[model samples]
Target: MRYAVIILALLILVVGGFAPPVVADAGADTAAGLAAPAAQTAQLGQDDSAQTTIVVNVHSDTNATWKVRTRHSLRSSEDVRAFERLVDELQRGEANSSLDEGMFRNYAELAAESTGREMEIVDVSYNGTVTDDGTTGVLTMSFTWTNFAERTDDGGLRVGDAFTTPDGGTWFPWLAEGQQLVIETPESHEVQNSFSGIREGSVVATGPMDLREQPIYVVYEATPGPEPPDPLSLELVAGVGAMLLLVVAGVLYLRQQEETVPQSDTGPASGSVVDRSPDDLDGDDPDSGDSDGGDDVDLSLLSDEERVEYLLEQRGGRMRQADIVKQTGWSDAKVSQLLSAMADEERVNKLRIGRENLISLPNESHRTNGDE
Candidate 1:
């Protein structure tokens, strides 16, 4: 059974894609110039914080795909162009590669986009639309990417844009006050691993603004296919069935043996009379030598712990420890020691009230809080 359980656990690990953990350094340098001018950042901070919303939809198929939507409200017309410039600076990376694939793959497309005077985005499909109301500017952008998620060695899927440049710089939209981000995945998938900012039921993060930090990464496992039986569950079911079958077989065999065996003589044989002696009969004779009506039984052989346990069982399995000392005439120290011993053995439970310990048997569901 032990070997079977270990084997099943190994099979689960093979089929379940366990994601490895990661630790991020907050002080790590981020990509330079990703931040719009410090003045622009300050200017936006002076006003009411604008809301930035980002949503991601992950679809599982032969090639898993992600559709991301980023919506931002700008304070002025200048901010619209500023946002555009930032978007243009995003550049792209290699197709079918992960930000976590390695340090080299992390910046392949970023390096390519950085080389030339003209801005070019690679590895992902992206487009944007902007609208201005003469006071506030609204920019909405959508990005559809393949190869966004990589399958871990353990068969888990990892998704996110948490990447650093060759020079130890990070990539992400600058967070500002009151800005919130939400990433949604399918309910069928179980999110086994995530960063600190990723919450369950859907990843959501609110911020107080940091320009240099990257987004959180999410790793999850897709629902398994139905063809192969789950080894862990199969082992459990087989163990239970075997035990139940043994119990049923033993019962049937015992019944059959009892039916085939000869019957015992439960009554007196042929003509014999069962003698009844005088001591065997009960009567109120004067010289019976019954001390105290034979009611008192010596309990000196029982230990203090045994006596306490017996008292608790006789009184509906509960009593105050103080009362036990009164009834048994044991010292406070002796009662405390006996109750503690009984508690260790789980024969009785003890709870402290105002100044005394309450003792009761385990699993007394009808027991109430008040003292009797």
Candidate 2:
């Protein structure tokens, strides 16, 4: 339950985005009103352009580990055409965020400073769960950004649109009237982490998971950038044409390869495999259209007896569910059931390995006389 709470908080923080800001009416006047039209300011000195929006979504786990990200958007009604440098500036900033694998590293340092805590996460699971008990399942994450003033500041608080850290990357922007920009958390992830395990830190995630951009759009101000490229102009005709050509060529190549290459059907195939024959299969999804015959490794489809045999054979006498899922792309439900069955057979001992299950096999595969 503690783990669940941590995971939920993690979900909320990491699921970044912008919630719409309440635009202040232009008719509002100040205490010393003299040619001063008042709209809401992000801060005392900031202009109305500092207005921003924010959004977020969250989830949790049985194990006590989690993440939380923020997304934000900035809006202003300044004549967009006047700022021809806008596109270039945005691109440059995005490029900085990406170059040298800077995003995570930058955040890690910033977070460490913000919380006075070192940043560390273990075993970032490529796997996610939407449980049979729907209440506990994690899915459909999003974020909304409102005014920064929503959160009360007591002790020496900082405010405004440009949320910059000591690190050179300007983390957030100040916003303006009717101008809109979006930022969000990535929905999909498949990264190899140093903390997962030395023995198995190199498993490629199996499935067509989308690696998406996540943005947190709450509370920020915009810093001006270079001129935006003219959309109607023919300045980058050759560049755009080349990009399209590459995409077309890549698509054609993939189609040609897919036809010739007999690939294993991964994840939940759109249809089912009806092979009832006694041939042993490495991969056999009950709901898959195609089967590349047993070449695909699917531990979930194996019978309970087969699971025990495989665990004993590989781990000497015991095996963990993590081993199976890491080795084979079994879903979480299948992994849980498979592991429970192994425990019934007294094949492995389960232990806590950060946010995941760890299995330890017995030293001996075949027990001698009087062995339990």
Candidate 3:
């Protein structure tokens, strides 16, 4: 009986060894199934522990400076090691690393393609650091994005098209959970309108919300520039004073000229009187007949100021005062006084260029150095 029992035990042991090992394989399969979800959960937890902040500074030229900061909580040694590895990779400029310039360029290209505008990312830089207490890791990246905002016709800025997809959908994949986006305008600008965002002074903050369903849009206008300088007031005062001086000088000159001219008596002088027919006096007046009778005979009927203005009109609304004197056969002082008076009245503009003054009608443009 003992021999039979021993033989049966041997046979059972042999059968068990030759079996397909199904139980061991089943246990390994169950363990792998259980570990996979745990690993996935751990990764998701790590991702949730990260906080991201993006700051965009919009400039008046439509360019933007972008700064992205990501903070990772180092809850375990594994997280610390992973963060350090990522920092090393980024420092080495490895492809597919965290926040590399190429990835940003790709995002910018995508934005440009969706918005149908030119976009360029430049001056990309990045840094990674651990907290002093070794409890957190921080990653920072910055760049300048050209044409990030659109300039409106009314001298304002329109933002938010870059975050949209080609099909009018939001690019929410760019935003992660616990992420914040802050947009700032130039110091000289103020937010005029915001579609959906929190406004704090010139800054607009968004996120920690559902950006996928609701995108952000903002419009800002440049503040009015500084008022005209005090020198302009001084210039007005000086101009009034100069005009008064010109008027006084003109009156004194007319008085001096009148005193110089011999007064006419009731009887004509022996040499000045001549036999003249009525036809000779046709279209002639005591004030208009004094010219030497050429093309200027018609101009003689005009007042001194009118004659100067007519000469300027003939020369296409702009003439040098010296040219006016040469055209009207007037003295320099007389043309200057007339132009000064016309300028004071805003009928003409006198621009001083070098050693000469250019006279133009108020509607005419001032002459540049290249002009004659």
Which sections of candidate 2 miss by over 4 Å?
1-302, 315-320, 362-372
| lDDT of model number 3 | 0.60
- The TM-scores, one per candidate, come to 0.33, 0.17, 0.49
Q: Given candidate 2, what's the lDDT at residue 282?
A: 23
- Model 1 scores what on Cα lDDT? 0.47
TM-score-sorted candidate list, best first: 3, 1, 2
TM-score of 3: 0.49
Q: Please list the residue runs of candidate 3 whose C-alpha ends up more than 4 Å from where it truly belongs after superposition.
A: 1-47, 173-177, 197-199, 230-232, 235-372
* Candidate 3 C-alpha error for residue 216, in Å: 1.5
For model 2, residues 114-152, the per-residue Cα lDDT tens digits are 434444333322111323432221211222211221111
Query: Model 1, range 49-112, lDDT digits (tens) per residue?
Result: 2344555655553133333333445666676665454444333422111111232233334433
After TM-score superposition, the amount by which residue 29's alpha carbon in candidate 3 deviates from its true location, in angstroms, is: 31
Predicted candidate 3 versus true structure: per-residue lDDT over 214-307, tens digit per residue: 5677888889998877988999999999999999999999987553332322122445443333422333442232333123335435666665
Clashing pairs for predicted structure model 3, backbone only: none
